[model samples]
Target: MTVARRLIPCLDVKNGRVVKGVRFVELRDAGDPVACAAAYDRDGADEITFLDIGATHEARDILLDVVARTADQVFVPLTVGGGIRARSDVDAILRAGADKVSINSAAVKTPELVNEVADAYGRQALVVAIDARRVNPLDPAAGWRVYTHGGRVDTGLDAIAWADEMARRGAGEILLTSMDRDGTGEGYDLALVRAVVERVAVPVIASGGVGTLAHLEEGVRPIARGGGGADAALAATIFHDGHFSLSEAKAYLRARGVPVRATEEGR
Candidate 1:
């Protein structure tokens, strides 16, 4: 059975505001996190991912208040990440109304945390986020290197191997972001996506570098057809900037024969 693909709008929050930039730098204000999420929900986003992009780097907790407020406003599933160092952090984020918690730096630092969260909350509630940059940006075949702390620190772990390890440790989903492609709007690193998807049994959400609706379609295209074969496609700049709406994205994907959950408007 073909699992319906999901469309997720990512909110990279810093100091309680949604922001965007190229390769995770020069971030400009995007909008209020809650408003952006509500808008995505209204437009028929299958899910919303709210990442506290600064928390891990700043050595602070994620804005739980914002998480709670966004939770109150959006009906779709919310996945929150950043500064998730311990099980307590995951517990708090979940209590803040996030359906799942995404962990990156902390997961790399302490792999056991993945086990703890999965054991306590079930694998469904644990998402391991991997931010990867190709070792040779000029060569896609060079493989990818993992980076954490909002893509600032190189973890020296092979992206594909790390993803497999996380899935082995009980992560229900892998949120794979191509740091080199992030905010570039070129497209996803389909090679990286395919490598991870081929290695892991868990769902992989391909993120970063989505510039066009065609990119979204390509993200979920079958690997056999030279596409990412991702379970979900996540974008921020395109959706946040009004380049397109979720309804339009869904319509585009459907027109291309991708089975996506219909939005209320599309329905």
Candidate 2:
């Protein structure tokens, strides 16, 4: 049986306010994270991801109180990332009600952390977040280097190789975000999405470059059913700008012959 495609709405929180910007610059407030999440939940969002963009470098905690509050009111699954370093941090977030914990810079800095968390919390509860920017075409060796510290520093690691390794280490899923396409509203980097999807056995949540319904359509095209395409697509700026609702996006995908979540059918 073919599983339906997933639609994820990302909340980039900083100082308790939902913020978003292009290439991680010029941040703008979106709204209250809890309120935005609740709206998405009511609209039939498959899952919601909260990224604490400043927590890591600032040495902050994963705002378990906010996460717990959001989880309490929202019915859908919630994935929390940012500032998750140790197993205790993971425990706090999960205990606060997050369905999964996402680790990026910390996981890259200490590869064993992925295994450690997966061993304790089970693979399904661990998500590896990869922030990648297209390397300068001139520097062929810079292909897909991972970014850290809120995309300020480059780790010099090949994304595909790292993704493969994380999967081998028992990562349940990969959240791949393209810095180049983020907040551009142009479209997702299909090449980047395809590369990561082809290399990892786990599910790939494509982030960045979602401006229109077409971009959403393109994001899930690679996972099409019956050799056709996948169902849902994720967006931040598009949805944040109030261009479309989650239900509307699902209806559009379904009309395009994609298999979206069945519950989203008449809404």
Candidate 1, residues 206-260: lDDT per residue as tens digits? 9999999999999999999889999999998888776688899999999999999
Give the per-residue Cα lDDT of candidate 2 at 46. 93
Measured by lDDT, the strongest candidate is 1
Which consecutive 10 residues in model 1 have the weakest lDDT in total? Answer: 21-30
Residues 1-267, candidate 2: write the lDDT tens digits.
378888898888876667753222122333678877877787778999888765553324436767988989998889989888788888888998999999998898899999999999899999898888888734434568789887899898988899899999989988887788887887876677777787777888888788888788888875433121323356777766666877888888789866778564454
Q: Least lDDT summed over 10 consecutive residues: which range in candidate 2?
A: 21-30
Instruction: List ranges where model 2 is wrong by over 4 Å.
Output: 20-30, 54-62, 137-142, 223-232, 264-267
The global Cα lDDT (0 to 1) of model 2 is 0.78
**In angstroms, how far off is 265's CA in candidate 2?**
6.7
